[model samples]
Target: MELSFLSSPQIFFTVFTLAVSVFLYIFIYHQTNRRKTNYPPGNFGWPIIGETYEFLYGNSEKFIGDRMKKYSPKVFKTKVYGEPTAVLCGVAGHKFITANEEKLFRVWRPHSLQKLFRAPFLPNASASIPRETMVNVTRAPGFIKTEALIGYLGKMDTMIQQHFNLHWEGKQKVQAYELMHRMTATLSSRFFLGFEENDPRIEKFARLSDGMTVGLHSFPINIPGTVFYRAKKAADAMRMEVQQLIMEKRAAMSSGIQTQDILSHMILSSNPAAGRFKSEKEIATLSSALVVSGFTTPATALAIIMKYLAERPDIYDKIRAEQMEISSSKKLGELLNWEDIQKMKYTWHTSLEVMRIIPPFQGGFREALRDFTYEGYTIPKGWKVYWSVTTTNKNPECFPEPEKLSPTRFETPPPYTFVPFGGGLRVCPGKEYSRLVMLIFLHNLVKKFKWEVLAPNENMIGTVIPMPGKGFPILLQPLST
Candidate 1:
């Protein structure tokens, strides 16, 4: 009876249909996943923790270079910063992320950064401060207008002049890191917040900034003794203090007092894109973000540039001549204008090369919004993408004699390769602003003095923003007027 039942036409038909359906389903699933799950060739390190120790505990370049040697150079898979990371190496990798942003990827701050600089300073899970306001206040016609920037040239020139008069003019010996940091603080405090050259805010802000910057690259451990904890506390305090300053500025502005600073302008401006003026709290947060991003980097870079210039007289002479020519064009007691800054091409290139060899800002991080393929390897959705400047900055193919310093290399560097300020929509909004300040400072520095680094072979200690290991003690020889 059982055999007869199995042999029935109805039973046979059902059995055949089920088998075909199963076969087709398996075939389709395998075909789809074969394309989707073609993950890049690299290990995730260990079980839950991944390769976090090897990645963070040693020289990052060696860690990355070793992986590229073991796997493919273009892209590789590993877990870092508590996420599955696709480290994009070389010029192609840098270009890929810059070109494909918003399509396959979006700006992603590390969770550590998010926890450290929460809302107002940075919008939750956002890549940067409000895009429109940051752009408008930085470069747009309505806000700190192009002409307004021209006005700032005079102010900056005076500040640099005063800075030298106070610090660099009479001194035979100085520490590059401390001096550059103070110079940066002087400009940032005065220009960003309208603090005077002698204001105490510089010291306070410096303290707050130090605490936060030290923890920027630390793991997000919130224990009382950890660096991350101190960073978070400092960041929180900075937010409160900045907001207080904003409140004071807002109250002052309401009474028809004259105020001409970045913070004041940010307060006065309305957001055309967002269709409303930013609140004081929002403005405070954005201002802090700008100061934090734009502040320390220029200082570190200036110190590095000084070290290079101190070591290379040919480079310094070219810059010295450029500044002298510009100064000759100006009348006695006359301040430098925007056009003078434009003529500093050689000086600018020299600075650019220094940045390339030792980038202060490094490259940024992004999140993959969806599954994407690059070089025939799949980057799964939600995986973090690391686009690096260090990898491309030292490529012998793009830069001939990668270890050698050559400012002329800037003339021939291929696109998306020499990214000191990074590239694409997420590029440093402070690029123009930084250029203005750095050039002005350099103009004064190289013109008035030729310095020699006492420790000519100072090694860098930090990675995120590389600082001279020895603080770059230098002997300053003043130029006769």
Candidate 2:
């Protein structure tokens, strides 16, 4: 009654051979599929898993660079997060993505991000608010205008001065990263929702925002007790709190209140295209998002700028001299104006140079609107596209002596080589806000304290936003002006 002679004596061997063959077949199929399609040169790695593990845990630069070396340098195909992605490298990639928004591509928030925004526990108001919706509201009024920005300078200067007066002055040592993060986070609460400097709610807002940010760039492992789960819960609480604030602001405005914060502005401003004021829900959505996302970049920039200042005293002295010159012209207690900011060119340049060497965000991802061809390779419709900043930011041809920490490179940067805030209609309006905060913080810093980096070669982690490994402790002393 045996199926065959071998089947009777070698059941284990037969089953083992079948499993290995199936595994090899799947591997070979995925590997060979690149050639099978009109796709770009590169393998998709193993089936199901793909190159995702390496993409997450391995070196980001090397991940792209290794493939570029082995395959065509222009474009390559790979799978990450269970999606086929086409990575476009260098300035050409930057130009193409920047120019082609809504034409051939669009902003592609990860499913995880979308899920975070629309969690079940959160209110349904945000469900209708797309990323583009926020952009439209940004153009409506407030925050994005130069007049509004100029008006904010004094408040920022005062806020930062007070921040340092309490947090920095007389402190023997501090974690530079934590210090900057606290400053920026508090600034976001005050600017966006008009929270007072010493409000207990500011602390609550910062803690909740930190919780929400934990899963923005992480995977969607939404189990009962995962980080993502906690992030979702934090988002719910944050949205509820912001909605309550919006309700209060609306009532105050109705009764002839005249306050000047981003929330009040949004409450009164109308979307010109729609010719109506943004709904309370819409205003709440934008305010909550700004509070959560606004502080991160400026905070990171300040921390890195300070780290570099400690490492290079010559740069520090140069920046300090510029700040001193500006201060000399101003009366004591006078806030920094647009004119003073313009004069801090070298200081701004230093920040740019630091950004070039270590960009805050590597780049953003986009989804193909339609099938497109670039560099003789086909990028299929519905595929994900990642336009990298690291590729162009570090390009030697674009930046001669790219590795050098030279702020003067910005005096005549190569055309379209580095755009820290992105370009075109897709450009983030928050960039101006970040610029003002970082420069104002620097102005206060150079005028106030000289710090020492406790751990110069401290290992940094995180591919997008690198942070010190062991710790980022620094010793501070007030400068005897």
Candidate 3:
């Protein structure tokens, strides 16, 4: 054979070794350079991987709480998402983190979320518009308005009855999470894109929503066979579907067949006179966000509430009584109105208590805008920060016996103590919309049937939202007339 320069095993081995050596040198150098004086005390763990596996695979709260006990209660440091992070815990920490939005810290999504969502209109450091401006556009009279919400109630009631008839009417057993997920997806689809519940596209959108949620906390790797890779694919599919829907809806709008769904609202609001105009891409992204947020959160919340109620019959009885009272007030074959929702005070209180115990959105991330000190420790500029709802919600100081289910706590919740929907300028705009979804669903669910969770002590577990492990299988029976 002809001698080939540098083709010897020895030469190949030398090059491989040099590459490995250089990688290690660069990794270690970056780790060393990232440290700062008086940074929150906690191990950075192994290079690259850091404490992500431990943080995600196990109880994230305990991981952060254990560090809080070891290092500091208010703030602790570790590496997650391949970056050094300082976790802020407790009511004080929540207040500090949320109250100082944009000024001290800006909204930060993991690379996976950025790639998955890719909504340029959303609040982020790179967004052209201010976060508050986005909020105003969403809250504008033309979008999710009071009149529009009132119109949604009758349709929701109809959808709920139809969903029950199709899915739960004759079934002796069903998975609460699975069923609720489907129902919410249907409702969200109807609202967002005017898609029918059984439209095949709703199921496709639901699958993509599930993928996004499951892959949210996963490592942001693009390699084939990875969770984030699948999620990105799902996102791409969802975007394509939404873009096509936007075209159809825009055509429908131009034809004078005005629809009152979210897409239509977005189109109408884009008029220059409305003082807000989002590009079709931004509208699609935002609409998909509505579908995602509308589907998963209320679904998780409804399932958890049902689980708790099944385990606590007395609470269930009270809720049933309240709902039964509401049903009695309505005329025969009448649908729910906005006033019907206002009267569900006690039931809403119970839902709030359940949320306190297990928030669907466990917490969120923020990135430091500049070097900032918290309780004597310096969080260096560009360091990621996490404000934990689990930590703050379960603080004994905030809730007398944090584990105890007490709806009375909401009678006069302490300021900044109970933040299921977050706090300050970054408060969720869909808060009322979520409440309506839950309350309406609860009303319909209770009036129709009583269920018992068949899974023994089925606990919640997932990075997306803590959902019951067995999907919370339950035995269903119609309530006696």
| Candidate 1: worst-modelled 10 consecutive residues by lDDT | 120-129
Candidate 2 ranges with C-alpha deviation above 4 Å? 1-32, 119-129, 265-283
Candidates in order, TM-scores: namely 0.86, 0.88, 0.89
Candidate 1: tens digits of C-alpha lDDT, residues 1-481: 4446565788989999999897887677446545646788787765445787676556666777788889988888888777888999988988888888788887766666767654443334333444545676766533245566777778888988898898887788998688778888778878778888898788888778878887777688899999889988888788788888888887887887878777887777756476444466666666776667667898888888888887788888888998999999999999989889999988988899998888886666788888878899878789999877778777778788987878887766689787777678767766777888899999988778888778876777666666788888998888975
Clashing pairs in model 1, backbone N/Cα/C closer than 3 A: none
Which TM-score value belongs to model 1?
A: 0.86
Model 3 agreement with the true structure over 1-481: per-residue lDDT tens digits: 8876776898989999999998988788667746555888877777777888887778866776788889888788888878889998888888897779989998877767767766565455233333454466567654456666887788888998898889999899898789899998998898778886678998889888888777767887878999889887877778788989888888887888867676777777775554344567766766776788777888889988988898888988898999999889888999999998988988999999998887877787888999989999989899999877777677798888999998878888888787878888888877777888899989989988998779868777875467777888999988864
lDDT, residue 208, candidate 3? 89
Instruction: Give me the displacement of residue 371 in model 3, in angstroms.
Output: 1.9
Kindly indicate the candidate among 1 and 2 with the higher lDDT.
2
Number of colliding residue pairs in model 3: 0
RMSD of each: 10.6, 5.0, 3.4
Residue pairs of candidate 2 with colliding backbone atoms: none
Candidate 2 TM-score versus the reference: 0.88
* Residue 212 C-alpha lDDT in model 1: 83
